[model samples]
Target chain A: MADVNVSTLSHSPKDPAKGAGKLDDSQGNGGIPAVELIELLFFAYRDFVGDADELLARLGFGRAHHRVVHFVNRHPGMRVADLLAVLKITKQSLGRVLRELVDNGYIDQKAGATDRRERLLYVAPKGEELARQLVTLQTRRFARALNECGPGAREQRESSSLP
Target chain B: MADVNVSTLSHSPKDPAKGAGKLDDSQGNGGIPAVELIELLFFAYRDFVGDADELLARLGFGRAHHRVVHFVNRHPGMRVADLLAVLKITKQSLGRVLRELVDNGYIDQKAGATDRRERLLYVAPKGEELARQLVTLQTRRFARALNECGPGAREQRESSSLP
Candidate 1:
């Protein structure tokens, strides 16, 4: 990977909307979009997911496992096809992770009542517990950040739900 | 990775602070944190970083390369040790990624003026362009999300600067 040169690689044509014309004067006329905001987001996300990463590592699971368990736990009776689409991963890749979760009793798979061929996924009791813990960690971080954002931020957050 | 069973693994003791006492009655007696918020974050981050991942893949690089280039571009003259601390990755791992950036003319490393032993990193012209493009993609997503967050969110965001 170290030997690979990015400059030599072919790039897709730049989006016209994101071109230099959009650069604000504050961005040094360099056509860069909000460098400060970008870096802040990078750091924020790193810490946001870091909490779950630590716990997942302890359980010998990675982000893949966390995603599968989390979604299954959240959307009980989610179809396998729907999970794959939501995750944007290959069926084979999802299968491996799903198999482990099912075999470990972290998730349960039941044939669809309407369509026997389709598998409906649900989180087991243990999976629910782990998922809750992970969500709790993240919610705390978000709560802190939202509170720090100012007085009305939390109220807005509570009033509006994520779609 | 898929063969790993999370349930068979040894469990760490639950944090006492996250016990049932902390559950808001509004969240239901299940003690689950904001599941919707957690899933929203997962999807948001997945798409957020996916844009960069596609570009990096074209260059035969990965997230590690993007992180190195992004930081070096953001903080010109960053010390190697400081970068190591900020990235929280092993020196060897950082070395692999940093070497690629330097070899590919995306980063310039010079000996520190004071110590003459520490290596300070700066982004090259090409690196800046790539960094800006990646930032632009993410900024668009953030802008949309902020707008959807309702009226006063943007104002609060402007007043608060993340360190």
Candidate 2:
């Protein structure tokens, strides 16, 4: 978004670690060189999630449903209580989203093995497929960023910058 | 929020390498081990932009202001059309939000130097301060997520699983 610097960007011959995070910190001297990584994170993320959103919308699903599906897929046997904690949404809201996800065959909710009251969650074939689609969409975006942005951009800057 | 990790949160790690662009194969991975990074991103992002929101609440500013501020700050000396392209909002809606941001002294405007019809933009000192505070608040959250999630945790399993 700003003027590009050959040294701050493009592969540096000086040291494999040189451009780490410095390119975006334009002013020189003591600025966080790693800011480049930050922008990449921001820009890449905006575009990355955007890709998934479009696909989800095509199927009449929204970001909320995608999030629910992701969590269920990630932790196959978690509880509703756990989902609530992680999502931090009111039960009423979660109920609406989860219900739709479950009803649509994208997710599966099983009776808790130990406590009948708890609902154990998993990604059913349908849910897994959609989740797979969304996550895969994002992963590709990230991987591309990683490849073009260089493998050790952040690592190179880590030694010189503060978090 | 699931079993996925947010380990490298709180202190922003030295971001290793981040990417940008539209070059996606659609089959890319988000690099699994680092799946937690996505969650950290979700949590930390929600938390990161939250403070400015609270401050804005006192002044009737909302997330729209945040988006406006973020973009303007990201590309200072940007044009209205350029901004509109980035935002993808209706002109009427955009006009309303833009007027509010300008009225609140959170942004400034000028006639384009070369193209008189083009309204160029910049963040006023007050606006810049607010944007800085808000973006920085989120920045730290990111720093922490990276640290806790570990540099390598999210490196591999990015794609074919998003959601």
Candidate 3:
């Protein structure tokens, strides 16, 4: 899996705006978006997720676990099929993560009221508290970033608008 | 690792705003932040990185590769030590990823002009193109999300302003 050939993958046409090997020195070099903004988003997301990551790490849960508990907490009584669809993972893959969450008491799974075969998921009290704490840490970061961007940040939208 | 005890982890004092197991029926339920926003951020990030993820998957590269090529391309002539610091990974771990990238013509390393013992990193033409494509995909998402948020989005910052 680590040795896949990248060349065989479908490649997009070379973008004229992205001058090959040219350093981006200006905000929008001839209408090309600044590389800084791209880097900023990357770093911002790294830190944004890092908050939950630290907590999850201490609890021996990974990002997959966080995702499972988070969605279950957000949308109570969500069906297992819907979760698999939203997560875009195989049932087998989700099975491992879901089992950990359920066994740990963070999530409770029950048979669908109308359909016994369908599994409905809900966060337990413990799970709900954990999810809220994780969300609070993340939302705080978003709030801070939004505040830092300030009123002038809207200009990015106008400038980077698709041509 | 999945069997670690969550109860043993030092948890923060229960937040009054985060009511105990109360379903979030309203936006900002009594001043508590909406869980929907947290979920939005999660999904938004999932798709945002998914763009680059697909491209990387084809190349037999992973997120670490993306981060390496991205930073090197953004800040050409960055030192290996600096990259290691920014990535916060052990030198041995970086060695595997960096070696593959250099061997594949995606990155070029040269002895530092001032300090011959130091290795300086630069994205090769191939890398520059790949990096640009990935950044373009992600930036487009940011632009679209920012626009969707619009002026009214600023109100969120005002409402959730840090004391």
Candidate 4:
């Protein structure tokens, strides 16, 4: 999911209460909560991706590769075209990354079901294992954060914390 | 933020019942909660930026430009070098965005109090108006979301959602 987005900015006096930590920093303006949004983004994003990257690296891949792998795994036998729509990346951009995954034996690209001209994608057991591992790994961080936010803010936590 | 590092992908799955959204799609090896985390990230990031994008757009800037202005507004009298570090982008990458903010008269740059060569930045009244409009708008959205999630998940919301 790494794409060009400028994130993380230091919060100054505007925030007297910084209890919320890194994630809250980005969302705030002069207020503590607004600024904490940045921190949350950094911390959560970092912590969420931490382990997945390790597993992907061992397979000679990165998060971008994992993202592709995960989506394919999520939608087994999906076409390259569908993938392009979801990923919103140029073929040339995806080609190099896709090649790396395919060459590594993580993906199984077969002819499309209806359109023989299209390439359909699925994760090999190995790819599935990695994608599963990466996704599962990332989910833990989110879960913990959610839990920590406590039972009271469950719904609020889900909706507000994100957008 | 798009450049996900190899080391940072160390994320693990969290318990869904722990308060985060339960995945609605197929359990797919990683299970519903894990998948939900992915969706949550998507939803959160979208809403986070979406809110800001609209508010900033009204002021004649996109997210790229708005980000710089937002940060400066957050940390009044911020030093250029400090801003560069917080943003984690090269001076060149930021130069255009920063220049627009300055040239458009949303920000005021002065000689640093401590260092003559450094530019200390602040949001002009005009900039502050934009920032206030934006930050206030986002804050209200967040506040309302929090109100909806109710007080049941307060701790979790505070810990995971706020950050």
Give all candidates' CA lDDT scores: 0.64, 0.61, 0.65, 0.60
TM-score of chain B of each: 0.69, 0.65, 0.69, 0.67
Give the per-residue lDDT digits (tens) of candidate 2, residues B7-122. 32221223222221233333243433335546656665455556556777887888777778766765666677766655556778789889998897888988876668867777
Candidate number achieving the greatest lDDT relative to the actual structure? 3
For residues A19-100, write the lDDT of model 3, one tens digit per residue: 4233232322334354555554455656677778889999899999999887676567777876776676799999999999
What TM-score does model 3 achieve against the real structure?
0.69
Positional deviation of residue A119's Cα in model 3 after best superposition, in angstroms: 0.8
- State how far residue B9 of model 4 sits from its true place (Å): 26
Candidates 3 and 4 compared by lDDT, better number: 3
In TM-score terms, candidate 1 sits at: 0.70
Query: lDDT score of model 1?
Result: 0.64
Off by over 4 Å in 3: A1-34, A150-163, B1-34, B140-163
lDDT (tens digit, per residue) of candidate 4 on B1-163: 2211111111112212322334333323345456645745544554656677876777678877766767677667777876776555699988888888889898898886556887888888888777767666565555545443454643444234210
RMSD of each: 12.9, 10.3, 12.2, 11.0
lDDT by residue for model 2 (A1-163), tens: 2111112312112223221223222223235434333444455456666788899999898888888888777667777776776676789989998898888888887787667887788779888778767766765655555554465645543333111
lDDT of 1 by residue, B75-115 (tens): 56777776766666789999888898889999998887777
In candidate 3, the residue pairs with backbone N, CA or C atoms under 3 Å apart (3 or more residues apart, or in different chains) clash, namely none
- Lowest-sum lDDT 10-residue window in model 2 chain B: B11-20
**Between prediction 1 and prediction 2, which has the larger TM-score?**
1
Across all candidates, the chain A TM-score values are 0.69, 0.68, 0.71, 0.68
